[model samples]
Target: PGGAASNKTYVIYSDNAFPPYEFLDQSTNTYVGIDMDILAAVAKDQGFQYEVKNEGFDASMGAVQAGQADAMIAGMTITDARRETFDFSEPYFEDGQILVVKKDSDAKDLSDLKGKQIAVKTSTQGAAYAESKKDEYDLKLVYYEDSPTMYTALKNGTDDACFEDRMVIQYTIDSENLDLKTVGEVLNPGDYGFAVKKGTNPELIEMFNKGLANIKANGEYDKILEKYGYQS
Candidate 1:
């Protein structure tokens, strides 16, 4: 078991809501997802014990910076802005931001959303992307703390559409039977990576990178992603 102490133990921080990446199984009272599985595999291959703890995304990053957590395995995008704050391992997955709107809505693309209300989670890559286009589209950006609340704002007619990762929005639409559909092509093709506090564990980061490369080379990576319905 991984925990906060001992040289053999590595603390991992992740939010419990990003499906296919990390989420709680209420029935089993345990965290399970592609992220968890990959971490477990990496730990086994690298001969280290790791435990994952649920924490908000930004908080997790902060924990790593503060030396409270050894690393973070959240579904964090590798943005240039983020690179200035922490070091990221080689990307383990690639994803992109997509638009989600109620079925039958008038909004078809960013152009169609001129003067429209849009919802996005604050501080996310999606939000940054939206913010960049806010002026061009004449959009009113509504920021939420998390994905669930942003979806809620759209469902309750508080916003015209929500922007987030395609996989996450797709999972919610299917699981909740939401009257929502993804629109247009994905806007930003981004890579997700494990984050470590700057200058703390080069050795551990090297080990994780090696493990990740092994998984991809050996086909375990694709198999795990396929199990979660991720095409890429």
Candidate 2:
């Protein structure tokens, strides 16, 4: 792997505020999290160098699609819709959507939210999931550009509740000491993958898959997850 192209530093984009996946480390003034650590470990194992841009998730997706960035690993779910535009590496993690509301909320399930507003992040699985249930639940959808703002909307009463990744919302609640809680069962259970524009950088996907397998076998992957309070 010690070749000329291996020395090239690729550009990797990720979300700026999705904690446990990717987020700014204020004390160090740098980005760090599960996705960051996994990318660092995988690049090292596969002998590649990269620079990560902590752009918000939607912007990161656009950057990769527009060829402005080489790849992304923003806890992006691997779905048929995204597959049409991006080539995803083998799944690195599993996740699911969850309904989140304020801790004092008496919402036991989606039925309790009838005619209420639900917040969703733009161009995300959470948004899609909420959209799918909108008419069935007589819900109104409110869009936010990022996770923090979406959660803020829920907390400030701009929206009654929101949909978010199960682990992501849980992590944010614990880390920020927020008064939020998830209700109902997980939905749209799926896996997350590293991605590049379709057919543009198959080599990058290859490297990621290879390094991922190696790390999973050798225990680095589990260590990274456990570092962020996850059990493999």
What would the per-residue lDDT of candidate 2 be over residues 100-179, giving only the tens digit for each residue?
Answer: 99999999878999999999999999999989999999999999999999999988888999999999999999989988
Q: Compose the digit string of candidate 1's lDDT tens values, residues 122-197.
A: 6788888889999999999998877778888988899998888988888878877988899999988899999898
Number of colliding residue pairs in each model = 0, 0
Clashes of 2: 0
TM-score of each: 0.90, 0.96
**Which ranges in model 2 have alpha carbons more than 4 Å from their true place?**
1-5
Point out where model 1 deviates above 4 Å: 1-6
RMSD of 1: 2.9
Candidate closest to the true structure, highest lDDT: 2
